[model samples]
Target: MTRIVRRLRAVAALPLLVGACSASAVFADEAATTTSTTSTSAADDVAPSTLERDVHLFVIQKDGSVEEHDDSTLRANTTSGVDDIAQRYVWFNKDIEHVDLLKAETIDRDGVAHPVGSEAIRDVQEPRSAGAPTFEDGVLRTVIFPGVEPGARVHLVFRKTRTKPLQAGAFAYLVEPTRGPVELQQLIFDLPDDLPLYADARGYTALPPVTANGRTRYTFEYRHGTYAPIEAGAVGYATWGDRLMVSTVPDFATFAAQYRSAAADPTANDPTVTSLAQSLTAGLTEPADKARVLYDWMRFNIRYVALFLGETAAVPHKVVDILRNRYGDCKDHVALYGALLAAVGIRSEAALLNLGPFYTLPAVPGYGASAINHVIVWIPELHLFADTTAGGIAFGTLPTGVMDRPVLLDGDGTLARTPAVQPRGRTTRLQIDVDASGTGTFAYRVEDSGAPAELERNVFRRATHRQAQQIAADRLRQTGLHGTAHVSTSDVAATRGPFATTLQGTLEHFTWPDGTTALPALTSFAGGLATQVQAWLAEPERTQPWVCIGGDFDETAEIALPDTLRVTDLPTDTAVRDGFFDYASHYVFDPATHVLQITRRLTAQFGHQVCTPDQFAQMRGTLQRIERDALSQVVVKAGRM
Candidate 1:
C-alpha cells in the first residue's frame, strides 16, 4: 500500500507580506548563491528537490488504549522551490480518534527557525468514506508553513489517540512503508511490561527490541536508499508486501474465540425467525432445499450497509435489528442467516474470510483484525459456503476471492479452508442459414454454470431488453458481422442450476464479393477467445504474474449455405496445449447438405490465479495459435442454380 501526504493552503492573516509574497523571490536568490558556491557533480544534478524523514511511534497504555505520534521533516534540495511546498495535512477519525498538533515549523539553510502561526491550522472532513453513512468519520488537520522554499525544511509532528480499542482487550497495528525515496523512516512501539505483544514483519527484516525506563521499545528502521518505488500492475502487494503488523492477541484461535463471544447466539430461539424459516421451507423436506430457501430469503430481502465504528467492526448487529431494518453488512447477513438455518435444523457457522487476492493465511501467529475483511455462513454438514451479502451468488457457490482460503469459524475456534471450486464450463452454439444474396438468419444459445452463471445472472438482472440486444449485437460485431440482434433469457431471478441465454439475429454481408466468386468470412463462435488472445499479445510484458480466472469455453457453429454457392476451401483444424490451458478447433464440411460446422473449445485451469513468466510465455504462444485458427475462414464458389 502507498501512503499519500496531502497538502492544503492557508487563508489566515499574517504579520508581514514578505513571509508570503517575497519568500519565493528570496528563495530564488539563495538558490543562485548556493549553486555558485557548490561544485557541479553527477550527485548534484540528480539530487531530489525534497526528502522526507519520518518517525512513527505507538505507545500502548495499561488499559489497552493506544497513543500514536507521527513526526516528519521535509527538506528542500534547492532554495528556489520553497514556496512550491504547501501545508501538510494529517488525517484522523473523529468518531473514535482525536488528533493533536505538537510542532510545526520551517528551518532555513542558514539554520534559522521560524515557527508556524497558530491561526494557520484548519480542520476539514475527509471526502471518502470506507464503511458507510457517507464521509462523516474522518477529519483532516492542515498545518500551514510560511517560509517554504528550496534549501528550507518544514517539520510537522502530530499525535493521535484511539480512546477505545476496536475490541475490548485486543489491539493491532499495521505500518506500511512510505512510497518514494526517503532519508530515514522509523517505526517504534512502546509496550507496558505486563502486556504481551506479538510482532510480525513481511518483505523486510525486523530488528531487535530495546527495553528502558520500565518500558519495552520495539524499533524498526529503514535507512536511506533502502526503499523501492512499487511497480505498476503489481498484484497482491497490499496483502503480501513488506510491512509490520503488531497485535496484542496471540493467535487465530484467540481471534476466533473473541469473535464467537461477540456474535449473536446461533441457537437462540425466536418465534419470528422460526416462523419465517418454517414458511420458507414449508413443504421442503430435503436439507439442501431448505437451506437454499433460507439463503435466498436473506440474500434478496436484506440490503448491505457496512458500519464498522469501534466494536461494531468485530461484532454484528442483532438478528432482530437486521430483520426489522431489512438491511445490514456482511456480519449482519452472516448472523441472521446462521440463526435462520439453526431454526430450521440446519447447522451453520460464521466464517471469517479475507476477500483480497491473498488465498493463504499468514504463518505469523497473531489475532489481527486486519487478517479478515469479510464474514459468511458455512454449512459443515453440507460442505458448502454461503455468502448472503453477494446477492446473485447461488446457494452452493463461493466467489473466487474466498474459494480455497482458510476461514476462521466462530463457534469452536476451528480453522477450516473453503472448498476450491473448479472452473464451470460455458458452451455456446450458433446455427446460421444463408441466402445467395449474402444475408443470413442466425440462432445462438449460451449455457453456463458456477461463477459464470452468477455473472450472467447479475448482467441480465440489471440490463433492459434493449441493452441485452445491444450487447448481443456488440458480440456479433466482434465476429465481423454488422446487423441487429434480439436476445432473451429465462427468468434470471429464478435461482437454480445452470443459466441459459438465447439470441436471434440477422447478419448482413454474410459473404464477401470478389469478382464472380463469393468469400465466406463469418465470425467464429470463438470470437471472444480470439479477441482476448490479441489483447494479451498487444502487451509488451506483464509486470505481475498473469492471472486467469479459471473457466472452460466451448463454442460450435453450423452454417447452411445456399445451393448456388459451393465450398471451395475450409479452415484447417488446430490443437494447442500449454500449462493449465488447452485449446482445440475443428472444422467439418458436409457436401450433401452444403453445411459447414466449426467446433472450438478452450479450457483454462486458473485455480491458482497466477502464472509464472515462463508459463505466461507458453500461454501466450498457445493463445496466438488459437487466434490464428479462429481467424481462418471458409471460401465459396458459384455453383449451378
Candidate 2:
C-alpha cells in the first residue's frame, strides 16, 4: 500500500483513490494461455511470456464506497524457460481496505486444475530504515501456486473493498491500460444511477454506459495481438497515455475548497512563529529580501519526510509539530513557510502542484486530488512560486517540475498556471594545456544559474570535496579522456546567485597517435550534452510528442597545443535554430599561439514542454548537429608553430 501511495504521489494527476489499483498485478495474472513447447535456443528461454487476458472491475456503491476486483489468466508455454507469470502479490492498507483472494490455481496442459494450498499464502511487513516512519497500517500478501511449469496456466482473482471514501461522499477510480501483448483487456465500472460520476478516457475511447438493475456500467476494453511497448526515452506510459478517470467530485473549485479546508489554519498569529520570523528577518528592509531569508531558512532546516497515510494524505501536519520536529513532507514545509511569510507581513497562499512528467492537466472535468502531490507557497505580490521542499532552489525561481504547470491557489479556489522560468544559461569554461608527451593539464570553471544551479548546489551539499572531485573526473572521462580531477565550489549554502564550481585535472593520452600528424581528443563538454542529444534522437519515428523541460546550456573550451604541434585542420562551425530549440558552435584556431578555442550553446525555449512530431523532428536535427559539433576534433602536425 505504501509503495502504491508513493507511486501515486509521484505521477498521480487525478487523486490517490483513482490510481491505487495495481495494473501490473492483473497483467502478471494474465500470462497463462501460451501452450508449452520446447525452446529452440537459449535466447528463447528468457523471452517474456504473453498475457492472455487482463481484466478489472470496479463496483461503485451509492454511498461512494468502491469494491475493486482483478482477475488475470496466463500460461507458461516453453520447456526450460522462465515462467514469468507464476509470481503474485497484493498490497493493501488493512486500516482502510480489505483484501479477499477468491481463487489461485494452476492448470496443466492436460486440463487438470489444482488449487493453491492455503500454506502457500504468506503475509509480511515491508522493511523500513531508521528515521523513516513505520507505516504499520499496510500489509503485503503473497500467493505461490504449486506445479507452475511450461504447458501450465496460472489464474488469480482478488477483490479489495474500500471501507470509506478518501473524502466524504466522493468516489474516484482510475484504470490504466496494459502495456504488453494481450488477447483481451478490459475495465468495467458499475455505478448506481443516483451517484454523480464524471469519466474521462484518455488515449482511448469510452463506450456509452449500459443501464441495468438501477445501475449504470461504464466499460473500456482493448485487445493487443502483439506487444506495443512505449517508445524509448518516453516518460512513463501512464504519464501520457491511456487511462480512465472517474470521480464524484464536481469541479476544480470544489477540489480547491477541500484542500483549503485541510490547510485552514496558517498559524500566522502564533507567538513562537512570530518570534522566529522576526529573528530571521530583523535587518532585511525589502519585502522580497525578507521573503528570501525566510524561504532559505525553511529550505535548509526542514527535512522532507513524506507521510501519506489514510487521513494524513490530505491533511498537513500542524505548524507546531513541523517546527518542533524540524522535518516534514512538502505540505508541512508549506505550512511552516506560509506561517513565517504571514508573520513577516507578506501574503502568500499554499498552491497545489503536480510535479513530474505531467504538465497539462487532464481535460476531464472533475475535482480530484490525484494530479497534485506537492504544495508550495505562492507570493501573490511577487508573482513567485517558492518550493521549499526543493532544498537549494533559488528564492525567485520554481523547480523545473512545478514551473509552467497548473496550480490550485488555496483560498481563492482558482486554478492558475505558474510562470515558466527560462534558463539563465548555465556555462562551463574549460582550458587545456598539452605537453610534448601527449599528457595534458586542464582547468574548468562552471557557472550555473536557475534550476541547474540548484541541482549543482544539491550535488555539492551531499558530496564531500574528494567525492566531488571523483564525480568531476568521471564526467571528464565520459568525453573519451582519462584523468584525475579536483573540484571546488562557491559557498552554495548561503549564495543565491549563479553557483560556481572550479575543477582541475590531468589528462592522459591527450593526443592521438598518427605519427607526425596528431589530433586533440574532443572534450565531452558540459555534463553529457552529446550523450543526451544522441539519446533524444535515438528513435527517429516517434508516435508520442517529445517533451523537453525548459533549460539552456553553454560550453567554451580553449585548448593550447604544445609548441611542437601546429594546427592543420578544424571541425566545421555549425548553427541550427527552431521554435523548440537552438544550437550554435564556433571554432577559432590561432596559428601563431598554437591554440584552438571552441564555443557552443544549446537552448530550449519550449514554453510548453510538449512538442509535436514535426517539432520533434526539428529538435532532433538540432541535437544531431550539436552532437556532431561536440565530437569534432582539432587536427595538428608535429612542428613548432
Candidate 3:
C-alpha cells in the first residue's frame, strides 16, 4: 500500500493494490501512450524488468475510512533486474493505518512457485540517519524474495485499512503510472454513489462508471509495450506523463480556504511574539526591511527539523512553542516569521506549494496531503515571496526549486505563480602569468547573484577542506586546464548580498613561448555559462523542450607573458546575435608589456524556464561561434613584436 500522507508519499513508487483480472488491459490506447518502441538488436538492449500486471483498488466509505489493496507482478529479465527488483518495500502511516501482507512468492522460469516465509518479511520503522530528527510516523515493511534470479517473477499482495481520513469528509488521490514497459495496469475505485467526486483524468482511458449496490466503481486502465523515451534535460515525468487526480474537494480555492481555517490564529495576539516582532523591527521603518530582519533572525536562530508526524504534517505548531525551541521545519519557519511580520503591522499569508521538480498542478485537489507539500510566506504588499527555510538566499529572491511555480495562498481565493529568476549579470576574472618553462600561475574568481549565489554558498558551506580542494582542481580540469588548485572565498555563511569564490592554481604546459597556441579559455570559471552551452551544442537535434536558465556571463582573461616573449598574432573578434541569445569574443595584445587580454561574453535571454527546439537551434549556432573564437590562437616569438 502507498502511504497516502502528503509528506510521506513516494512520487515514483507504484502503490500495491487489489488486482482486478476481469477487465483486459488495452496497450493500444493512443490517448495515454507517451512512449515509443524500438526494435532490439539483442537481449542486452532489453529492459531490465517488465511489469506483468499492476493493479490498484480503493474503497471509500461514507464515514471517511478507506480500504486500499494492491497486487503487482514483475518479471526480471537480467541479472541487474534480479538485484534491483528482488526486494520490495511497502510503507504505511502507522498512526492511522494498518497493513497486512497476504501473499508473497517467487515464480521461477520453470513455472514453479516458491512462497516467501515469515522470516523473509520484516516490519520496522522507517530508516533514518543516526540522530537525525524526523516527524514522520510511518513504518516500512521489507520483503526479500528468496531464490530470485533472472527469468524469474516476483508477486506480492497487500491491503491497507485507514481508520479515518486525515481531513474529515475529504479524500484525494494522485494516480501516476511508471514510464516503463508494462503488460497490464489497472486502477479501480469504489465510492458511495452520493459522494460528489471531482477527477482530472487526462491521458487515461476512463471507463463508464458502473453503479451497483448503492456504489459507483470507476476504472482507468493503461498499458505500454515499450519504455518511454527519456530526453536529456527534459522536465520531470509528472509534468508530461499520463496522470490522473481524484479528489472530493472541488478546486484549489476550496483547499486554500480549508487550510486557512485549520491554521488560523497560530501566531495571532500572542504577547511574546508581539514583543519579539517589535524589537526586531524597532529601528526599521520600511516593511521590507523589517521583514528581512525577521527572515534573517529565523534563518540564523531557528534550527530546521524534518519531522512531519501526524497533524503537524499539515498544521504548524504554535508560534510561541516554535520560538522557545528555536527550531522548526519549513512550516515552523513560516509561522514564526509570519507572527513577527504581523506584530510589525505587516500582513502576510502562508503559501502552499510543492518544492520538488513537479511544476504543474492537476485540476482536482489531492487527498492525504498529496497536493502541496511545502509552505512559505507571501507578502502581498511587497509583492514578494520569502522562503525562510532556504538558507543563504537573499530577500525577495526565490530559489529555482519553487520559482515560476504555482502557489496556493492561505485565505486567498485564487492561485498565484511565483516569479522566475531572471537573467542576472555574472562576471569571471582570470589573471594568468606564464613563465619561460611553459607553466602558468593563475587566479580565477567568479562573482554571481540570485540563485547562483545561493547555490555557491550552500555548496562551500557544506564542503570540507579536502573536498573543496578536489572541487577546485576538478573545476579547473573541466576547463581544459590541468593543475593543482586552492580555493578562497568571502564569508560563505553570510546570509546577505552577492557571493564570490576564487580558485588559485598552477597550470602545467599552459603555453608554447615560441609558436602559436590558442589562449586557454577558463571555460569552467564562467560558472556554467560557457561550458554548459558548449555541451548543449552536442545535441543539435532535440524533440523535447530543453530546461534552460537565462543569464549574462562575462569572462575576462589578463595574461602576462615572459619578458623575452611577445605576441605577434591574435584571434579575430567574433559575435553572433539571435533572438534567444547573444555571443561575442575579443582579444587584444600589448607590445610594451608583452601581455595578451581576452574577453568572452554569452547572454541567454530565454524569458521562460524551457527552450523550444527552434530556440535551442538558434542558441546553438551562436554558441558555436563563441566556441570557435574562444579556441583562437595567439602567436608568441622570442622577441618583441
lDDT value for candidate 2? Answer: 0.66
* lDDT tens digits, residue span 1-641, model 3: 37422111322111111112121112222212333222121234677777888787888876657888888888888898886568888877677778899999999999999999999999876653123344455577888998889999998889988775655565666666555466877778788888756666655667778889998888877665554465677555555455666666666787778667656654556899999889878888999899988888887788876433122235566788888878777777888888889899999998887775556666655532233667889999999999887776777787777776678887665788888555366788889889987799999888887667766877888899998888898888767778788998878877666788899989888876666555554434634566657666656565445567678888888888887676666678887888876788777777788667888888877776755555666667677776666666676766545
lDDT of all predictions, in order shown?
0.64, 0.66, 0.70
Q: How far is 57's C-alpha from truth in model 1 (Å)?
A: 1.4
lDDT of 2 by residue, 1-641 (tens): 21222111111122322221212211111112111111111232333545667677778776656687878777665653224566666766566678888999988889899999999988765432125442344466777878888878778888988766555555655444444445666667787776656655553346677888898777767654433445565544444554556565566677677777867664546899999999999988888999999988998898876433222245666898778878877778888898998898999988876676555544432322335557788899987888888885778877767876778888787888887555655777889998888788989887887767777887888897778878887777766668778888898665477888888889887874334644543443446456557767768766554555656777788898787877778888888887766888888888778788888778867776555555666677667677777677777776665
Best by TM-score: 3
Cα RMSDs of all predictions? 10.9, 6.5, 5.0
Q: Candidate 3, residue 158: CA error in Å? A: 0.5
Clash counts for the predictions, in order = 6, 14, 12
Best-to-worst lDDT order: 3, 2, 1
Q: What's each prediction's TM-score? A: 0.77, 0.84, 0.88
Best by lDDT: 3
What does candidate 1's lDDT look like per residue over 1-641, in tens digits?
Answer: 01225221111000000000011211233233322332231342433334467777778765556677777787766554454345677755576668878888898878888999989989876544344442355567777888777778888887877776556666665444433345667767787756656655543345666677877776766543322332233334334334455566666687778777877554356788888888889999999999999888988898876432221345676787778878877888888988888888999888876665645444432322234667888898898889888877788887766776678887787788887555576778889988878788999888887676876877788798788888787777766667778888877887867888887989887764332444433334433455556655554444333335567778888998887777877778888886766888888888889888888888877555544445555666766677678677687876632
Model 3 score (lDDT): 0.70
